[model samples]
Target: MTGDTQSWRRAAPASPVTLDDVARRAGVSLATASRALGEHPHVAAATRARVREAAEALDYVASPEAARLAGGPTGRVAVLVPHPSRWFFGELIEGLEAALRAADLDLVLFRVGGPEERAAFFDRLPARRKVDAVVVLAVAVDDAEHARLASLGVDVVVAGGRVAPYPSVGIDDHGAGRQAMDHLLHLGHRRIGLIAVDDDARASAWRTALADAGIEPEDELATTVAWGGEGGAEGMARLLGLRTPPTAVFAHDDETALGAIRTLRRAGLRVPEDLSVIGVDDHPLAALTDLTTVAQPVREQGRRAGELVAAALRGDLQEPLAEVLPTRLVLRGTTSPPGAPR
Candidate 1:
């Protein structure tokens, strides 16, 4: 044998250097070492560097097969979606699928919309060990649900929304809301109303924008509904029943804006002539229907999220990242100055 081979054989330990040895040498917990080696974003940079240096000193090498058998990467990612049938979710899925496919990873979709469905999914997650990571698509994970995911020992990524302590890619909801509301305000529409699914950032923006414009937001002008077209239609009907209806309305999304227009048409009113309207998310149909809206890059958010998942799996993510894309106002035929001549 060569001299170097002989020296290596003499210096090598009787047994392989275990991860425990590296962790102990690095002065970190076992989990911290694993997370450091795995490139989890939550680990401190100094800790990761120390752990890596310890592994090098100990000549420790991680086994891929052993890691896989012990709940390591399976080349598949689990994607949790609230409303997969909706246009927004569909676009997200499309972009995510493309990026994951390019990275040679498979996507497993789970619909966790209702409370019962969410409960069941979280309750059974511990029993399932088929995925390397979980990607949440526009679903707000509660404290309990987040704990359940934490117990899974897998990385989590969020798309289209922000969840604490996890990497995410999305647009600024408050900014998008401002784009829609400010467009109406610039059109000289002082009496504006808001139709929202929830009192989220967008709703907050509505209130803030009105206050900044030196106008007090009326409680009667803000109406919350379920979601989608039907809920929007009902909200619009309620707004119309008010003593003084708004000269302009800001619906939560394009679908909601379309529903409001339906209500207006039923009342024999013309858009931008009798009243102006605006919304967020330039859905595909929004352009066809001439709905003015704040256009957000829904698909790009998904694609970026997929990239994050890939980076996490490859042990390259140095820190938790929250990437916010941009939103812009898209003026269409639906919005104009209040009582402006058509």
Candidate 2:
């Protein structure tokens, strides 16, 4: 209270205002003050307003580290990939990493390839508070899995395929399939077989296209197999053994198409000469092997999904984004008019 003592106290620099000071001023717990400042949705509007006013009065600037410890963004994203070794997933990861790195976020990968792995991942993710967001890469999440993801209380994004109730970026599978099926239909082929990895939108496109073209879709002409060259080979063999074999075949992807071509070679039937073939996803080997396919912007899908995650984190995204990039048919030596002379 003395004049000299007051003068010395005024001369000393003021202590930086802490979150505790704001909490005391707002008559709330320290955790509540932190949640309000962190923009956690569970805080009441009135409590958040009171905390903001207290922070402003005290000139409290939240440290990034403090905010992170108080349940804010961890600056990391978890990417769930079904097949990490595949080229498609590799391209998606490359694009996603670039975009996330630009946004100053780290990418963590989790492989959920099979039923047991997926179940374990879903079960374990909610128990940990490691990532601020999750990106699912070409994996179909079931209802139970979706519920588990929701329990994480973080943004969820889908890339390379569509998943309902979440932001997503990918090409239209049915549209891409239509492009492939229509190409073969245009090339003077009436009996076109489908070699499918799954009975998804692409398989539906094949059936619809054939029906629209006034050709009955035969069950024997359409075969389901695993994903990859070996599966394609098996499906093609089944088609070839049919009483009335198709003049052209549409494989699920370029790799599968290549496998189908290999089967034809083994059977002494030349590609596009004895039977035409087409596929989706213009994988790098597709061009090298001269396989015709529907080219999708696979990497772009990943990049866009990363951008979506960034926007959602910044609270800039107004709504859940469902972006569908375009796909185009790429012609190559594998496809031609049915039975055209070699």
- Structural similarity to truth (TM-score) of each candidate: 0.84, 0.81
Give the C-alpha miss distance for residue 260 in model 2, angstroms.
0.4
Candidate 1 regions off by >4 Å? 1-52, 55-72
For every candidate structure, what is the RMSD over all alpha carbons to the true structure, in angstroms?
Answer: 8.4, 11.1
- Cα displacement (angstroms), candidate 1, residue 94, comes to 0.5
What C-alpha lDDT values do all the predictions have?
0.86, 0.87
Task: Using lDDT, give the best candidate's number.
Answer: 2
lDDT of 2 at 175: 94
Output the lDDT of residue 106, model 1.
96
- lDDT per residue as tens, model 1, 34-71: 76787755456777899899999999888763253234
Per-residue lDDT tens digits for candidate 2, residues 26-108, read 87655456667888654567778888999999888898644753596578899999999999999999999999999889999
